[model samples]
Target: MTTQTAKNKAMTERLVEWDKKHYFHPTTPLKEQQAKGPAHIFTHGKGIHVTDVYGKEFLDGVSSLWNVNVGYGRQELADAAREQMMTLAYGSSFFNNSHDVVIRLSQKLASMAPGDLNVSFFTSGGSESNESAIKIVRHYWKMKGQPERKKIIALERSYHGVTMGATSATGVPEFKNMITAIAPDFLHALPHQTECELGDSSAPGYERSIRGIIEKEGPETIAGVILEPVQGVGGIQIPPEGYLQAVRQLCDEYGILMMTDEVITGFGRTGKMFGVEHWEVVPDLMSVAKGITSGYIQLGAVMMTDRLRDELADLSDNVFFHGFTYSGHPTACAVALKNIEIIENERLVDNAKQMEQELWKGLNYLQDTHKIAAKPRAIGLMGGIELLADPDNGTTFEPSTFAAPAVVEECAKRNLILRPLIFGGLNVIAIAPPLIVDKQDIETIIATLSDSIQAFEQRVM
Candidate 1:
């Protein structure tokens, strides 16, 4: 090899060694990583593609953890971060203090948020956002002299975050099982039970639905209901028509707060500024992250209705007593502001909506070409296809088969990156490319995934 090539190889090898020795990855198998080294050492990204340290490039099908809505390598976001850092590297939101960028971002979010969600409490990311929301609702009840209303009801198969409260609120068994001891007062109900949520006692599984649980546990003791507008980590499960509306009505009838976790579906991931807008349902509280800055910076916020904020302000005699040091970091806020401006100026939301049609066509094609592909689902750019051993009979693959991960690995071999959502006995392949992707990009991703699925079929069938 040439001298430059040799130098690059040496650097890659050294970095790999250091990573195997010291790096502790999240949501990874420690023993496997230590034994085999990292799967890919990404060095840089531009648009919807990321390049590894070994100079191999791949299309990022999952948007680097379902963020990066505006894609990667945007000079505008970089400049915004730099300018804000130069002006004010860090600013805390403590003691009721604030900064210009934070103030501006809050107002922008308020304007963009659904209904009267005009107030924002900032955090560093999704977990913090969910944690703050949980605390806020519980604290609200306490301030209202009903501290017994501390129970939070989440939906089964939902993925909130990894923080203590978020983890407890998560309905994914694997996540909650990670720790033997989790926070209390977090209950999970059957997901997407529209009739049951609407108080249809005759519906199948009604006793396990949110409404049923509230009634069984005493609605007076329930503080709020938390659910994702579009379940992300739980196999991109889209709620049936009127599902969200039914949940909102149930919460209203029971005097409980309805909170939607928009961490994944926010910022146009679902063809709208916020996913709840599709159903015209206004949640009392909403937690958002990820695309708020298109993953350029870590930032999140818990937004509340004006009425709720006013009530909390009136009820509390002391400080709220919760916030992060970087609650409203000026640099992060600046990056977010610029990132949002780019999204609006470029009309990426419209692009995502337009691309949904193309994605749907591709998903259908995959189902038609592959006998194992079934239950195709898509909303905007977020979509998933279930892999079954026998589609006609709805038979799932054995857990030990690891079918989804195997197909995803085949896609990776074809220079494409995809995520397998195997949590909760699911064998689903999630497809959520960046909003910047076009028809050609969608075609490439679908074609690659088809070949990968075929390879898996040949292996198993």
Candidate 2:
């Protein structure tokens, strides 16, 4: 056979063999998928678009699982990584020793983080970052001689991470059913469902419900209250006015540490550097990842207030015994340092702020035109369009009906990659394009999504 024929044959064989073995995808039913065969094979990515092995291009509507804030195929980020690897690729952060890049990135993060979150703890990703925060909170109270203060309050529909510890902290039920029992003492509070037709009454009612949970659990036993400033996996539930402030006050009154998981909302995904900044509510500890290195390299960080660090310092044996081998990998840190610099230099955050208005305007237009759309919520660059089976009655379709999945499939057909909210029957189309996406790309995504929703409506009807 000729060289060209040989390459094509090899590619086809690889796909068939991959289906036969080698891929066990996350968040997918193994038996069903393996029987169906291998999914789309992504060949390359560049600036908010990805091409498959067959060269069909799709707009990265969800920014490749909500990272890639600076978009794809960034040469500067690649260069930074190359330079760091050439110098020093790996280092253990176990001892008192540290590297220049790690120290520099730590200082930069401390400075940019909201409030007095001065101490930094590095992890490989969001799950580990959140896991570290949980350990720190428990350890902080133990050092303070409140060993029984171990209860943690998380919000319903909130997603912290998927580690055994962090997964327990997540309030979605689907993550809980199959897994072994998570640690006890973790309580879930009511989530803010502003998009629900129940109206303004639901906001105060939800806050009161959370307050009741805290009181019943006894404030002394509660170590911290962990929440997402804007619940990402929970259909992009944005808290209403006074909700975050009320929670802050409640935590203060009960002496509970307020932990904000900004893994998705940090580093300009929400226009603001940190989601809590939008509410002006300071958190005791914050967990961040995703855009930290613009998805060029893996890195997550936990930022805690100086007071919390000091409290831990006061105890002779209060060391946080948890970390990953790549906790502060020099290459990752160097890439992140350059990433942040690039974000600042190019004013991507401000660009996100500008594009956010246009994106929301386009989505709102869809809500007005499409009968399936119940409500649309937009905050900065993060937006969600909740689709209802009966918009007139505000009734949601059953999950088994797979309405959202159908819509998602339609979106994929239109070359738009969208993610479905794992919680609730509400069909939410989340849009958080890369901060570097220009107006033309934004328009393309909006138009494609609008067309996809229309096509979905036609089929479902």
Candidate 3:
């Protein structure tokens, strides 16, 4: 090997050693990480790809955790962050204090948000955003003298975040099982039971639907109904037509607030600027993150309707008593403003909408060519392909087989990064590349994934 190459390899080895010794990664197997070091030490990213320390580049099929809507290495966002930091290195929004950039970002988000969601409360990320939304709804009911309305009903298989309240509201068993005692009053119901949600008691899972849960627990005790417009980490399960609308109506009928977590589906990730636009359903409260700053900076916000904000304002004379130290952080807001500008100027939302057709075609091709590939689904650029041992018979592989992860590992070997959603006995391969991806990029992803699936098939089937 060349002298520089050998030196670089030595440095990478040292870095890996340091990482293994010090870094405790989130959502990773600690023992495995200590044994094998990191899977990849990413060094640089541009457009739809990220390069590792070993000089190997791979297509980021999952947008580095379903964010990075505008792709990577955008100088515009960096410039914006730098400018804001230089002007106001650190400013507190506490005690009614606010900065210019935060004000501008709040207004921008208000304009872009659905319905009358004109007020903004910023947080650092999705978990904080969700935690804030839960608090806002519960506080609203408390201020209205209905303190008993503290229960939160979320859909089964939904993933909100890791914060205490978020963890309680999250329906994914694995996430909640991480802690023994989750916050009380958080309930989960069977998801996508549209007929049951619409008051059809004859539906198969009626008793386990959101409506049934509300009825069983008494509507007056429920504070809000929170859900993702298109479930993300819960296997990218897209709801059926009329499902969101039905939930909206159900919440209205019971006078319970409806909140949608747009952490992964907001800011043009799902064709429209927001996922709720697909059904034209306007939620009472919306929590958003991820695409807000395109993974360039940490930022998130909980948006509520003007009516709700005004109600809370009129009802309480005391302070809101809730906010993060980085709430309305100037640098993060600046980065987010520029990120939104990039998405708009480049018409990436339109691109995502147009590319949905291409992604659908590719997923269908995978299903047709691979016997294990089944139940292909896509909305905008977010999609997934489920693997089953017998598609015709609806039989799944044993969980011990680790079907989806093996396929995703093959994809990684082919220099294309993808995520496998195997929680709750699923074998779903998630495909949500950056919004900046073109038709060719999608084709490359599909071809690589096809070969990867074929490799897995050859091994097991």
Candidate 4:
């Protein structure tokens, strides 16, 4: 019975009304939603699809906001949460109070994280993970008695998160437009999007960008550089080859910490355990979330290196302060453990590699077909098809045209949903389907997106 009954129908409408009237959604186009009620009153989900209140099912091309790595409605995860709730739901992790689940999860993360990033600090989600990253970076520097090194550098088109600290690091203006306040000393650098196109002769390769920023900001004031190896929300912008290595060398040269925000590219989303592996680079710190629990529960973690840990221990006899009340929540930890187990047992990461090929192939075919001068950019299961304004001229449409949203709406008409990234001169449809997505799923998504692009092209012409 996917259809809502008369009673359920009445309640559903009421709930939609309540949501519009009271729900304060984050990162949402609030004014538009207030006028349109709700785009989807989703009620049920399973595998890679979700059903709405009207019994309409749509392919989750964006993986329900780029998470749900193991797909939706996993019984195993639910069971794990249930068991943990029944056994040990609430336990204080503060003041050295701890639990077994978090300890084990930390050990697992230590084993998985690159380099000596052996410590795990928990948070409620990506925003908090990055929020913690900034604080920990500064606190680590402070403990070193170099309190002046408070500035952070992140790449343009890089998105860390939405918290004050994270928002300051986010490169997209839309994420920061509403905020009247932000943390000071957050700097920006160029992303190596043209490394291949321009070859090594590019004026600002990833290395030069970081070095130039450090030189201008005075490396003494810079604490670290934080960026996504695969810029997910930033149009799934895949960093050029050797980009991570270049940035790593610069950070080492400047005695600055290198941090990777893997909130969107972590887990199996990038066809690797973590996004940094694609470039074979390890950083002093890493912030991760999203796929950590496959969106079953709210959870995030930041990994710290042994060197930083030891230094902080040596310098600070005083207690260090920072953490959320739900940090290492027992139930969330249990679900995360189960989620990882499912990924391994099902071999979702390997599946992602196999499926990613299908995705790119479909995207390549779709982009090449419509004479729209589209570029398909992706890594693993995450990527997008970017539409250009003039195919022959390689120019982008003016911002007033709303090209990306038009594609989004056209695709929606075909029962395919995608996220539109229309910021900082990027006009593309971003997608990160569940790692369990198959070839047919890829074909459908690509076909629908292609049709949308064609429709947009006609309108523009």
Candidate 5:
């Protein structure tokens, strides 16, 4: 080998060794990864693309775990973070201590949030945001003298987070299988999208599922219902028309709080500032993260309605003990403000709205042309293309066949990265690119998927 080749190989070996020795990656098979190393050692990123250590490029179709809303490598975000760190790097948001950026960021979020969602509680990421929401609402109910209202309900196949409370709240079995019994009183309801599929069944839709649960537990024992406005890890399942509205109505009827976990769909991911905006439904609480700061610095927030905030305030005169050390971190807040400014200044939400049509048109064509594309659906930038062995008969390959992973690999070989959700008997390819993606980027994504699907279909044959 040449000298340059030798150097590259040496670097790769060193990286692999170091990672295997020290880095414990999340959601990875530790033993297998330690033996085989990472699939790609990513080094840098730009708008809509990421370059591996080997200098190969790939479209960031998964938006780097559904964050990076402004796309990658925006110097402005860097500058914003640097400027804030230089000014005020760290400040304890404890004891009513606050930073200017944090205060300003809170005000901005309140103004943008729908209905009376006017208060903000900060965390380090989505998981913490969700866990925090659970505590906040349950605490509120307790203060209101309803200590029995401890049960929480979520939609099946939904993903919340991995913390004890958040993991218990998550509806996916894979997330809970490895662990022991999680937080109690966590329940699952049938998703609205699947309701119509089970035609003529006694159980109709989300309404009945939730209603039945409430009846079984007694409404007085339930604290709240937490759900994703547009399900992400649960196969990008979009709520059917009037679905959220019906849920909101149910929550009201049952005297239970409703929280929408917008961790993945918030901040322009769904062509709107918030996913629930599509239904004009005002949830009592909202869990937000990921796109909040475009993943520049870890930041998450729980936005509460004025009514909920006031209830907590009225019920408690003592210090309500709940918050994170990095809660409302000045640097993160500053980065988030700058990121939101960029999103607004660039009209990224509107761009997402327009590009979604482009995405749907392409996915629709793929669905018609490729028999593997059993059902392709997109709402704004979040979507899924369900793969099947035969669309005519709705024949799906057995999970052991690994068809979804094969299709994802096919896409990656073509310099496009896509997330394949294979668990829970799903063969879904999640499509959620950065909101700042342009028309050309959308076309490239579509073409890449089209070719990948065709290749995968041929390989299966």
Candidate 6:
């Protein structure tokens, strides 16, 4: 064989070897992956694009697992890490002792977060952040002398995290099947898509339905309700008009704490500083990560309003009793501080607002010509393209057929990485480019996705 042929064979063999040995991927069928061998390997990234080991570049439409909002290879972030490491690598947030970086970051977050949510409890990632929030809400109720109000009401298809406690909060059945008797006090409300899928007006009816579920569940037994402003993994399902406001009203009336999981929509990913800002709703507690340090360092936080914090404080013996070893690590906090500075200085949040409009328009333009597209939802830099078996009837393609997955694979082949969201058997291709993505990059993503869907249609149909 020629030299080029030899190189290709060597690369393919390496991948096969990797598959045979060390790699246990998440949310994937192990047996199927073992049969298929190693998947695509990203070697490097610049701006909104990543290159594989084979030197093929692909648009990073998913932004490295929905983080990396500031994009890749930011030298300033690297410098911030280096500087912090040289000074103080790590420190515990235990007892009354803390680092300057951690203190400053907490104060900054308090100021930026909506309402009186001034307390910041740091965690290792989104999962832990959510886990902490769960613990805090439960503990707060206990402090209020209502330990019976331990139940948490979350929406179906809502994703909190993966830790045992946070996983229990996730309403998606697939994530909870293996763990039996997970959490006793958890209840799931209907999601916003119920009315939309049933071909009814989704605005007022959807809001009323969710409120009815909360009422049926008896708000007295519930401690809190957790929801994503825009469901990320749940096919980017945006709630209809007055949905969030109505939920807020119901929560207030029932004395239930409102928790917003901003793990995927915080720090300018949603064109604003946070996703809840879009609806002008103030959450009693907010869980944030991902863009906290632009994914430069491992950090997640739970912000609590003064009301909840005061409740914890009022109890003389209230321990609250939860923390991670790496909570408020000094170096991570320093990096986060610098990352926030970059975001503010570069005006990336404002850029996301503009890019969001451009991206929505671009995707809508494709929908006019692409028959497979349905229910295109776009807000800020986050969006989703629904793939339908019958666009006119809004019927979904079967999961076994894997039409959405096929489209994703085809897009990958054409050097564009897109994620397929499967919820209620509907396929939604989630599009969340980095906040730094430009008009040219948006054009490329749209063209690539449109072509991929067309190619899949030609082959599958």
Give residue 223's lDDT in candidate 3 (0 to 100). 99
Specify the poorest-scoring 10-residue window by lDDT in model 6. Answer: 193-202
lDDT of 4 at 221: 97
List residue ranges in candidate 1 displaced over 4 A: none
lDDT of 3: 0.94
- The TM-score measured for candidate 5 stands at 0.96
Stretches of candidate 3 exceeding 4 Å from the true structure = none
Compute each candidate's TM-score over C-alphas. 0.99, 0.94, 0.99, 0.95, 0.96, 0.93
Off by over 4 Å in 2: 1-6, 193-208, 317-319
Count of residue pairs whose backbone atoms collide, per candidate: 0, 0, 0, 0, 0, 0
Candidate 6 lDDT tens digits, 1-461: 99997898798679777865788887777887788765677778888888876788889898878889889899888998999899998888777678888999999999888878899999988999998898888888877888888888788888888898888989777789867768777777777644432324444544435565555666667888889998898888888876787778767878989999999999998889999988899999999999998888899999989878877888746455688899999888988988898889999999999998888888897789788887888888899988888899877787887988889999999989999887568688999988888999899999999999999889867
* Residue 219, model 2: Cα distance from true site in angstroms: 0.7
Candidate 2: how large is its RMSD? 2.9
Which ranges in model 6 have alpha carbons more than 4 Å from their true place? 1-16, 193-210
Candidate 2's residue-wise lDDT over 73-177, tens digit each? 989999999999999988888867688889999999998987899889999889999999998899888888899999888988888888987999998888887
lDDT of 3 by residue, 1-461 (tens): 99998999899999999999999999998999999999999999998999999889999999999999999999999899889889897789999898889899889989998789999999999999999999999999999999999999998899999999999999889998888899999999999999999999998999999999999999999999999999988888999999999999999999999999999999998899999999999999999999999999899999999999999999999988998899988899989999999999999999999999999999999999999999999999999999999999999999989999999999999999999999898999999999999999999999999999999899999
True lDDT of residue 193, candidate 2: 37
Please give the distance, in angstroms, between residue 253's alpha carbon in candidate 3 and its true position after superposition: 0.5
Relative to the true structure, candidate 3 has a C-alpha RMSD (angstroms) of: 0.7
Off by over 4 Å in 5: 1-4, 193-208
Better of 1 and 6 by lDDT: 1
